[model samples]
Target: MSHDFDLNSPENIADPYPSYARLRTEAPIYHSADPDLWIISRYDDVRAVLRDPDRFSSDVGGLESDPFNPGLEMPRWLTGLLSRISAVRVLLTSDPPDHTILRRKVSRAFTPRRMAAWEPRIREVTTRLVDDMLAADHPADLVHDLAAPLPTTVIAELLGVPTERNDDFKRWSDNLINGLLTGGPRIPMVRSAIAISWFFLRTIRRRRRDPGEDLISLLITGEGDEALSQWELITFCILLLAAGLETTTNLIANAMLAIFDRPVLRQQLCANPELAAAVVAETLRFDNPAQGLMRVTRTEVTLSDITIPAGAYVIPLIGSANRDPDRWADPDEFLLHRPNLGEHLAFGSGIHYCIGNALARIEATAALEEIARRLPDMAPAGTPTRITSPVLRGLRSQPITFTRTKIPAR
Candidate 1:
């Protein structure tokens, strides 16, 4: 079959399933000439690429252009600034030894214990946000009111970001992620990256002088060469803001949309709060927040009857893989009770698998439980807006409405 897939097209961005289905069947290892990237769409094929990191390396340093093709032409100075920012390699882009070291240092602070400890606080924050929405008016936007802020607030606290600078962190995160998803003018993205790097560097310096019980302080106080460098610390903070904030934000929003779209499913979840966890898992498979991720081939490799030359870009379409017919019975349907949800590549697989998966799940479960219990009757008040980025699948704004429950007198 002819390969005519356009990854950046609006039709694919709004609804990529049909395209993904066609690609998976016709050209599972199709190469797109426009982007000059190889696309892998089958579930097993995607899993194979993700697990075999040695062949499909994450270290895309020598690539001629940004794998996602942000489409920005920057002044040389801004380009240099972005280069300096990129130099502080985080786990997402690093492979093997470097990834291992960086992961260890960050893991010291981002422990399972710490994440478990945040559960109550996550619930408290969610309840408060729902309370605020309940008090304000009907037709509240779940994205802004709850989904966006909950993870940002929780992550800000974990990272020890000062309450006053929360807005800056969110703004910087949005700018960086937007630049990544849909490359626009280079200046704004470059400026935001520079500003955020400076902000994090300043915070790191403060943590050095006066260490506290936060992730940044932990990284600052860690010992040995394995410990994160000042620049690495700053970059990790930026990574955390993006990973922790954006992904979880979308998970909640996507889960809500899935539940609301199915009245019976919504009622079932509202009736049995335990089902909320299942709903989250199904959403991760049905409409994963991250649509795909890029990896560069270290050497010539053949996958699914096609030989991709060395240094070529290969993208594992996570969204498509999740719905692969061979893996999932009703690949496109949202099945809350679907078994073996652990099989989904939503958080990816292999060494580069998302480290914050646990935290994201906890935050999402808590948010969904709160919404199901409190806003059970909530329905879309207006057309939900989608984030028009090829790599990110999420709502830009999801306005919803329900009968406002009266706040009991304090």
Candidate 2:
């Protein structure tokens, strides 16, 4: 198997499926010497790594290291500052015991009943955003106007943050995600993290004085000794904000792009609006928002006849695994009603599976349903711009045009 895979290459970034397919078939476990990382592309291999965390640990500090400064050769003061700001021990980066406890405490806030209750608000928000887009102009950038803001607003409401401050939240999330994705600069990323930390700290203090029916309050007042510390609470808040906003934003935008690419499918979805959920599922399988995640080998591990030394970085290619030929009949094609769509490793597997999976699905389903119902004839007005990052896969801007639907009297 050839080891020339370069994740940062322009060609690969633009369309990774081709490279992923070759890797899956030729080298399910390939090592790249340039970055000193192992790539796992097979569905079973990726699933196994995620499930057996005992062998493949999630405590890889590289997950949070600055992609720009991987060597940690910065000045002592700067390195210390980065460490302080970036040392977030959230569910995504913790192992069992700690992960189990954090997950249990956080699960209390995302009950099925609560998610069901959020559906109406999600629909209302979607309708309003689409209404604004319809009123303004044709060729509106849906990514910015709708797909992006909707999730930020939803997560803000869930976190009990003031809706009026949603723009601020969006800025913070964009800065953090862009920094992590492109390794643009260290200062802005550190500053954004610090600012978000201070905001959450203040919010936590306020919630202590005046408790509210929100996630912050739930984390603050846990059962027995399971409550989170101030730092943990702050880290958890930032984690929820970043994860909930970025993933769902990408899901909605990516689903829109995929559906619009196939006019027949788009029309079919519009005619039968209930199939919106199928669109979401198919999108997750075909073009997952999170392309892959990094996990380290806790001990020597053998995958696909390749022996990976202990303490080595392993990347599970979720996007590639979702489209593995062995896993699906027509792996690359977007079939809305694919029976195995739910089996994709999009939300990951095992205990580390996305806690906000339900929320993301609900939000995406609402967005798709509203778009199909209101803008049944929506069409792409220009080429969609894709976000270029090895880890995050999504559209940065999608210009779309549609006939304005009249809003009925209240």
Off by over 4 Å in 1: 62-87, 137-139, 183-186, 407-410
Expressed as tens digits, the lDDT of each residue in 1-410 for candidate 1 is 57568887779888999999999889999888866899999999999999997899886655555544436443223223433665567677778877887887787676788889888888888888888998885558989899988988888888888989988877776777666455545566677888988888888888888989887887777567656888777767777776667789899999988887798898799888778788888899999999998888999998878899998889999999999999999888888677777899999998877889888989999988887777778889999888877778898898888888753311
Which residue pairs in model 2 clash with each other? none
Per-model TM-score on C-alpha atoms: 0.92, 0.92
What local distance difference test score does each model get? 0.81, 0.81
As for model 1, its CA RMSD to the true structure in angstroms is 2.7
Tens-place lDDT per residue, model 2, 256-338, is 88887898998899889899999999999998888998788989999878999998889999999999989899898888788
* Residue 349 of model 2, lDDT score: 97
